[model samples]
Target: MFAIVRRHPANIAWIALNVALLIVVAGLLVAGSRVSVTGYYSEAAWNWMAGQSMYDTTGTGFLYLPHSAIAYIPFAVQAHPQGDVAWRIISLILFVLGCYRFFRLSPQKSEFFNLSAGFVALLLCADCMRNGQATVIMTATMLLAIDAIRRENWHLCTWLLMLGFAVKPLSIVLILLVGALYAPMRWRLGVGIIVLALVPFAFQSPDYVWQQYEEFGLCLFHSNRIGYEKWWAQLFGMLKAFGLEVPDSIQTASRLLCAVGTLAICFVLKQKLDSKRFLVWLYTLTAIYLMLFNPRTENCTYCVLGPALGLFYAEALCGRRWFAAGSMMALAVVILGSFELGQHITPQGVPPVWLAPLACCFFTLYAAFRLTSELNRLEPPPSREAQPVLE
Candidate 1:
């Protein structure tokens, strides 16, 4: 027994730590209905069976589209008469599993980071009001696609991306566009995956689906061209600093800029995407793009907090002491200005929605602020890649 213990010390230690964290998490969640989607998701779900509505479209001086309509599906799945307590509990559980899967899907088995990643996933369940699981589903799909493409398994990649696009249209652009940087051959597969995503759902209402395609343009124009003041205030402020409106043209341009920047990072900066570190950057870009450019990112939508927060917290596991100290200071500002920390999570910084994203950009040194610029300056990641696998 002594010899066995000596041989598997890290293994034993990690198991013990995971148990403690799991217990603490279960205790916190079960204490009460503290972290919930509130009534919003149920309402959206109920509205779906009620009228097949999309995204809080009830009291709208605005139009509703079925494109964002799937928010109601899980609620419909749970189908509690009260549509309140029992149903949300189920969605919350799914949200947890989704996060767990996302973290597990990461290439590294670093317990420090994996468990930290799991905690961040739990944070998604704890804070956000909108379909918290939606982002989970999206992350899962994107990660699966990344996995498939890395192995050059286009068949598997297509199926995974199809599920992602079916869940939410946002993945249609992010997964496909950003994916082309490393795996340009896979872009055609991406478009095919998107086309296939509609087949089964197409049977539901092909014309409505096509109409949603048309609405995509309107959605872009509405959010980009006609600005709404929400959490993205700082991000939009930066765009204004550039003397531009958030027009469809600018929306197109931003994506092009992100794409060009990504390519430049790969070619010019010589950043390589074939390493384990690639997903870190991929997810980072998707999250930041949402925060910076998405028309709205409410406090409830704090579900995306997992990837950024996970990367942020994992820095302590990194070998940077002073850098970690500075990150802690910056993280303090993020918590104070962004999250509600009353033992239960609430989104506090409505006026400063960009705070979380900006914090993510600042705090995650390995990816956003440092890498995009660094990668742009180098050759390509694979050639300069010092190790075959990046830690």
Candidate 2:
């Protein structure tokens, strides 16, 4: 069955063409002519082109970096109502493409596995698209970057990572992780690319760019202090929701400790394994960490974890079948039941929050521990042994 699918690229292309048409029609039906915050992205783009700052106080203010506005420029130039719909439609397309790219780059070899992973990935992204969030674009950027890393295309990897970083600064963590895997050589290149990417923005407005950095930090600080509903889904907010009074000081300390501990474990694993094995663990772990540790991780941000979850599930199933079933149950709880579960636990008028992602949190750590268990005896991980299904 899988072989038949593989042999028919023409069939796949035709299916894709029909799917794209359906996506456009569906987007038009669901979105209508309403312009949401994604329009603010276009607003920021137009304003930037007019010599105004990207972070100006207009229409829900663009929280992204200056370079990120460049991506919205094409849509921004379109007329108002059309531009708004165009942005959403483009975002929808990116979500589909991102899923396809993720499956292709993933370690799930069979077409059935790839198709299943793609389905799960899109299901995970459903909320993100409904809200017209840029998280899908960020997901695509990460998927392509991972594919580049697998091909050892260091320059392509650097550029893709930068593109994502411009939208979601948390992506820098993944960039740093990749840098470590390739060590001194790739590290220099990755860092250099980041620095050079900033150079173009600096040329646009050196002083304003610096000030935008301050504004960006202040924005993050304010959002953290607010403790929004989405924040409740993250480490600090989860603690608070569980009746633990985590002060700002403790929260800061806890985040630092966890981040350092995660990195330390990854570094030790790197020493024990070669590039391929190390990358598999590194990418999966870092994806989870980006959402787990950060206070800004909203429901939409959870879309980024879809690929990591798929990778972990594949690895688990290949190893201990029972463990695979358990993880799937946990994931089903997260994907299907988390919202209602969160609503039942919280009071009226409060945003829905869930503790199920915490299950994923623990599973990530367990996966890392399993991967790095033989640090004392440095032989390659057992042949055909199930590591993370990350390419």
lDDT by candidate, in order shown? 0.49, 0.64
Model number with the top TM-score:
2
**Cα RMSD (Å) per model?**
8.7, 7.5
Q: Per-candidate TM vs. native? A: 0.63, 0.77
Q: Any idea how many clashes model 1 has?
A: 13
Q: In angstroms, how far off is 159's CA in candidate 2?
A: 0.9
Model 2 steric clash total? 0
Pairs clashing in candidate 2? none
lDDT for position 108 in model 2: 50
Please report the TM-score between candidate 2 and the true structure: 0.77
Candidate 1 residues 129-167, lDDT tens each?
A: 223335555555665565565566766767676666656
The residue-by-residue lDDT of candidate 2 on 130-207, one tens digit each, is: 556677777778777776766778778777777777776678777766765565337656576668557547446776
